[model samples]
Target: MKFRYLVAFVSLFHAFSSWASDSFIVKDIRVEGIQRTEAGTVFSYLPVKVGDTLDEEKATEAIKALYATGFFKDVKLKSENGVLIVEVDERPAIAQISINGAKEFEKDKLLEGLKQAGISESRIFSRSLLDRAEQELKRQYISRGKYAVKITTTTTPLERNRVAINFDINEGRTARIKKVSFVGNEKFKDSELRGILVLRKPDLLSWFTKNDQYSKQKLSADLETLRSYYLDRGYLEFNIESTQVSITPDLRDIYITINITEGAQYTVSDIKVAGEPLLPEEEIRKLILLKSGQVFARQKLTESVKLITDRLGDDGYAFANVNAAPELDHENRQAAFTFFIDPGRRVYIRRINITGNDRTRDEVIRREFRQMEGAWHSTKNINISKQRVDRLFFFNSVNVETPAVPNKTDQVDVNVKVEERPTGSIMFGAGYSDRQGIILNGSISQNNIFGTGNFFSLDVNTGAINKTYAASFTNPYFTVNGVSLGFDVYKRDLDTRPLSRVGTFKTETVGAGVRLGIPIAENDIVSLGLAAENTVLGVFADSPQRNKDFVTEFGKSTNNFPLTLSWARDRRDSAIWTTSGTTHRLFGEVSVPGGDLDYYKISYHQKWFYPITDNLTLMLNGEFGYGDGYTGRSLPFFKNFFAGGNNSVRGYDLNSLGPRDDRNLSLGGSKRIVGNIEVLFPVPFMKDDRSLRLSAFLDGGTVFARNIDFNLMRYSAGIALTWVSPMGPLKVSIAEPLNDQPVDRLQAFQFMFGQQF
Candidate 1:
């Protein structure tokens, strides 16, 4: 193709040179040989116009300009009898594009990539462009570790000077890492350094993890990790010299080698604070993590600077600057550091600007902000505001920035940017359990309705033993002062044959409730609610003694009115995967005097999380509940609390841990106590991912009807996997009971899919 273009250019140049001495003027221009390109486009590229003097040089210039446009393959200029003729061969347009044999990537994604490479339909086609596009596709495959990928392109000519381009892609097996070797490391072994990296040699779990796949991005990130590891281990002058990635001849295996310079380790000899002390020097020193005689760590130094700056920011120094200057002592292998603080002018927020929220209302995001507009800037408040917005789960990302106002030294603007995510979910799931038989459940929920930050859900569950239908809605911001209003209505039908020894009878309940939440503090909420429910119990000849007595005393139908009061304080950093925080909730529900059943139930739940390491967290959760009849009525049997489930004791059957009836059916208790201690860690080979977690837990709980016996608690130990999958949140556990009785019900494996916990 290049040779043909070259010949055409040479021929046109030679033809123009022959007429160099002859010049023409006052002539009309004519264009020919253009099939798809408009005549106007040809004329626009022609340097010489009609009625303008045209010489051999002008003719040559016009031909060259036309060819440079990339719209034509050949260009010729001719002059006869004072008339200039411009002739060109337009490039063919791409009519269609087809890709085949591409499995690793979606068809639409490949098409979009081709479009970005100027190889889409209805565009001018050239052989050079096509070659470049093929190379680009190959690069994309290689980035995904598909080194054996082959791309073949063919063009079929069609009518009207258009061609159909097809790309035949053969995406072969991905290259796996065979070995990773490090060089120039004396203090740390190769295995130690490799453990710090995400990329690794193929292992038993390679099929599930894909960690052995060679990815350029992952390699780059691993290099950064290696650097950080050294810097945090007192190697202040560490540097990665070079890295080499090698693939086998067949492109199925890969080997990586990284070279580094492990500089001399240093210890901190002294630490000092310098510059203007806007606050007490002792207070600033308390924030420093560095100490004398300790090994110098770059991470700790950086953290110390950040803490000092944030401390100043809390006192209205929004633009404070803090720097750590190190003085190295080569002979002694010691380093002295001085932290310099610059408390810039105390700034006030001039305005708060919110953007990138197209679906959500501005007020919905603004209500989460703690830093008010026109108030003194506080970094603490700004960070809290960002976290609060994140907790809403309405946005994919929330970012806050402070930009100084023009012409104002002491004023700045707070810019909160959020990227909204889809907050509506529709889910359906089916499960089969030995106790419940076949169960089908579905739900439609929206956390953000019409950009109002309201939550609405419709839930339905149907099983052989149980059936329930419910709808609920909550307005998180019912008022400007952060009050919340919510309501719920539900109908449930329970066949007691499976779970209760009360004969083959059924119980039905219909209920409705309204609740209000008042915000007492930033993290505290007090709730009040009232509900009315009517219960109907069916009796049979084989009914149990307790059920027969209840039906005979209260009749087949009974009505009750319940009032609820609750308070909660939540300080979790994240709602989905909390690593650090504490949450406490206490609630009480009491049936009023005029109801058929008068009882009060009180419960307390407390949870705390402590970060054990960067990748591990320790969590403690405890729940206690107690209920009894008030005035003269006994506690309703249906209101009893049951322990033993995935959310309680994993090794036991659902709601099966308590007193048992004559037929060995679980009878729930009026007192409940459950506690769990878990260590949450990142799943192996997926440490960088936040959507998946693995936990080892110890759970103990028991329920009592009359007296609480702490020694009667059932203990279980288990390993759990939680994944925030695209379908929904999934939880799976395998557990073993430590203390199991002869008649105790045990379930070793429990799992729930397409549901949120």
Candidate 2:
């Protein structure tokens, strides 16, 4: 009321002053009472100029215009010696803003909000804007269910016509939803309906999800979800009549009530394709999800439209539209839907535009595109191209858009934008195991060297049991047809005398190899390689007799040429987080008769991922290996396969499962089998987050020297977590041996970093 009276008094004084002024001609203009605003600024807003006539109306207009600038709190006009004089009291400038007792949000965030509301430092202050900012701050707290929050603002005057503003905030306790009641839900239980809502009463996971908070936006979204739930379950006429939310007197609890009306369930009586589908009627009809006599589902109807539209898009109809028009028979509660398809135009790619590759070359990305410029536009091909680019692991995000070319009905441009991620790293890593104590390794690698899509790496590792140095280089696009060429050189020294789990021996090897990767299919690749190796054996007095005997028979040093062949087909949607797809790998290695050692090894592995729900995935993985000597020679013991580790069978000691020598030491075998089943899901309350995953797994595997025995396999069950952190991939697991004999060595906990297990 006081502020209103002040405004009224100011208006009346301006009116009286304007009516009393006499007509006069202005000689010059002068401004006073301005400390920060320039005198010319005041003159620029005045309606009366030096030569213009000044009258009672002009006096009124000048004052009004000057006040409207928001720079002045008071304005007065007068004339002296035929000169128009303007005096203004400028509004105080804000010198500083400070927030106190703010715990719910960062101070910078709150200050930014105030700035958006025109209440920032160094700006002319307005009482109205200050009040509005205060209210907005309260509203933000309310959104987080803090109903008892309070904010008190203070202004301290300073020299030079500036003021310091401070906000004293008390962010009270956040209220939790005490009850959520439905008034008219009958077909489905209240519990079942509540399960679909994002908001809920406080529960064990509420601390992480914060779903117990009552937010207006969350409620609105929940109501929409409720409407969709009913409509998707054949209740096409469902209506939400009202919603009510109430807070307790103490502001510690909230209650919600939603009233809804569920109409009679409906069934689909018929489905027909009506418009010019551009394709065969049978083919378009086959895409319809609604069948006669089936319950009407809005979700299926929506999916049917999308499927038909996408089918048309695959056929170069970039802007196809599919509308399902429904006719309702109220008495029988049946709906007849006619899908109207309008295949707008057959369009071709006018251009393929690429952007956002700050480091990668344009050719590197363009070569992965399957959809070519000047060809018919294909949505399928564009999507495939996006997947291919994503699989390169060179980018953090890949986005593709097919926008119509202006003024061209039959042409579209494919715009591909990608967010690049760092593809080069120099990492020094360390790992620990019961047997390998602490192993340290370092590598300098670049997957996209100089933006040319080439790979290069130099690695060095030193451990208590082994030491290695290696160099590798690969050109992923060695040819236009997606063939790859790579070369590797490595030297390794291994000594097993310090380990109790294996027959003790020592070996040194130096090798070099070249490989070629040939693309066999869109998802299949075959690689071939050959390496020349020289290995020297060092047998000690305490070494197993088998190792000493082999050294004596084959001599202290031997030369061998080893060949490798591998084929892989990977279709996982994402290499980082796979939800649905299958991956298969088949590998074989042989040291031909020309080498001092004649042996061959072959292995096959398969992984299948299936989505059990939007938030759950079932993964099945199996591996098999068999290696033996050919041409009258024995398989080298050092080349034998080993089981029982984090990568093989969890819950058992590393390399602890296989045939044991007379001294009860592990002798790794010539045959191996491993199987694993896992149910994978994101962490609780983080279903949409892709960087972390948790899984419950069952694992079984064993190694055999000659015969394969199912009963000899070790089994374990456990839960594991994998996080794709900024530093690298981290995996941790806790397992319980399900069927371990007294002879089996058990290891219940394991973890690895820098790479996946």
Candidate 3:
């Protein structure tokens, strides 16, 4: 194509020289040799018009202008009988684009890339563009570690001066890293350094993790990890000199090497503060994590700086800057650091701007903010406000940014952005248990009803042993002072055939309750409720002696009034799949003296989670319960606590771990103690996923009626999988009772879908 253009240029130059002395007046203009292009389009680009005097300069200008449009392949100007004749050859338009054998990327993605490169349907086709598009496709494949990929483009001419372009791609296998080596390491071994990197050599697990595949982005992140490893270990002057990546001849294997300079480790000699201290010197010094004689760590230094900055921010210094300067003493292998603090002008918030919330009301979000408009800006309060909003679970993501107000040096605007998530759910679930047979349950719930931050739920459950229907509603801001009001109504029918030992009986209960919650602190809540229930005991010919005796004593139906008090402190970072923090709950329920069967129940639950690593967490959970009849009466057997099941000792049958009767039916106990230790980790291939979890657990628990027996305790070891799937949350467990006895029943495998864990 370049040669053709060169030849045309030479011919035009010669023609212009021969006609330089000749000039003619153009009577009319006509465009020829155009198939799809209009004559007016040609005239739009031509420099000369009809009835205008034409010369060599004018003719050359017209031809050059026409060629510059890129729509014409050839242009010529000729004069015949005092008329100007313009000739042009239009470029062929693209009719269709098709990509074949493009397994690495979707066809639409590749086509979009071509479209951006000016090679789409209905656009003028150019050979140069085809070559560029081919190169681009190859680049995309190479980024995926497919260095051996081949792309071939073909153009087929069609009718109406249009052509169809096809791209055939052969994406070869991804290149795998065969070896990764490091240099200039004195304190740590190569293995230790490799453990901190994301890119890894080929291993048995590489197929699932894909860590062996070579990617420039992964390599860059790995390098940063390597740098942080050194900096955090007192190698303050460490540097990565260079890195080299080599590929095999077949483009199937990769080798990586990194060169580094490990400087001498330094111990902190002294730490001091510089610049004006807005607060007390003692308070500022307490925020410093670095101390004399300790090993110098860059991470600790950075944390110290952040702490000082945040402290200043809490004092209304929103734009505070704190820098840590280190002075190295090479001779003594010691380092001295000084924190330089810059407490900028104190600023106030002029306005709070909320966006991205299409469903929820502005006040619904504003109520969660601790930082108020027109108040002095406190970074600590701003962060707390964002976290509180996140804990609402009404949005998928919440972000807050502060920008200085225009023309107001001491004022800033707070912008809060949120991405709303689904707040309503309807679920139907089924479960199988050896003792309960098959159980079916369904529920409809909404956390943010009508975007008012209220909650409502209706639940229905049926099983061989129990049937229940319940409804509840809650208003979080009932009194506008962080007080909550909720109401619940339920009806339950229990067939004691499966649970009773000697004989069979049934119990029917209908109840309603109202609860009030008061927030005393950020993480503490106190709740009080009153419930009234009517319970009827049905006695059959085969009823147990205990059931018949209960009916004979208290009559067939009994009315009771129970008052409940609960105090809880929840500090978990996330309500779902929590990785850290502790939760403590204490609950007590007492039947008033006027109740037919006066009884009291007390229970304490504590859960603690410790993050061991980015992908691993250790959780310890414990529960204790005690229930007995008040006013010198025996404890109501119906109010006893039962242990064993998915939420208890999972290896045993549900509610089957306590004492048993002659018929081998489980009898509920008045006292219960259960403890569990779990090591939670990510699923092997989905380590970064937040919605899936795998855990190994050891559970121990026991239920006692009169005397607590340690020998009767049951122990179980199990592995569990928890996934928050689209349908609902799912829990599956496979457990084995470590101390199974003849009387204990086992449900080794248990799975439940569409239920909250």
Candidate order by decreasing lDDT = 2, 1, 3
Top model by TM-score, which number?
2
Candidate 1's C-alpha lDDT? 0.87
- Model 3 accuracy (lDDT, Cα): 0.86
Q: Please, what are the lDDT tens digits per residue for candidate 1 over residues 1-757?
A: 7997787768676657545447789378888898888899887877887788887667778877887898987776667788777767789999999999999899999899888888889999988778988999999898888999999899999999999999998899999899999899999999999998989988888777778998888999999999989988888889999999999999998999999999899999999999975989899889999999999888899899989988888777888999889999998989999988889899999999999999899999889999998888889999989988998999999988899999999999999888889999998887655566777889999999999899999999887778999999999989998999999999999876775432355789899999999999989999999988898988677655677788889988999889999999999877778899999999999997787998899999999999998878999999999999977767777788889868899899888888777877676889999999999998887877889999999999988989999888999999999988876677889999999898788889987664446
Q: For every model shown, what is its TM-score relative to the native structure? A: 0.85, 0.94, 0.93
Off by over 4 Å in 3: 1-29, 39-68, 79-84, 422-438, 496-505, 539-544
Clash numbers, per candidate: 0, 0, 0
Model 3 C-alpha lDDT per residue in residues 1-757, reported as the tens digit of each score: 8986787688577546444446899899987889988888888988888788998778888878887787877676767788787767788999998889988788998889988888899888888788888888898899878999988888999998889988888898889898899888888999999998989987888888878988889999999889888888788889999999999999999999999999988899998888877888889889999889988878888888889888888777888989888888999999998888889899899999999999988988999888999898988899989998998899999989999989988899999999999999998877654456777889999999989999999999888778899999999889878899999999999886775342467789999999999999988999999989999888887665776788889999999889999999999988887989999999999997777988899999999999999888999999999999867887766777888878899888777888776667676889999999999998998777889999999999979978998898999999999989876677888999999899887889977664455
Quote model 1's TM-score.
Answer: 0.85
User: What is the per-residue lDDT of model 2 for residues 1-757, given as tens digits with 9 covering 90 to 100?
Assistant: 7986789478649744744657877889888789999887877787888888888777877777877899988887777888777777889999999999999999999999999999998999999899999999999998888899999999999999999999999898999999899998889989998999999999999998889998888999999999889888899899999999998999999999999999999999988888889889889888888899999889899999989988998888888889999999999999999999889889899999999999999999999999999998888899989988988899999999988899998999999999999999999887655555677878999999999999999998777677899999999889999899999999999888767667888889999999999999999999999999999989888777888889989998989899999999998877878999999999999996688999999999999999999889999999999999988887898888989878889898878898888877787899999999999999987777799999999999999998898999999999999888765677788999999998877889987665435
Top lDDT prediction, candidate number: 2
Query: Which residue pairs show collisions in model 3?
Result: none
lDDT of 1 at 107: 90
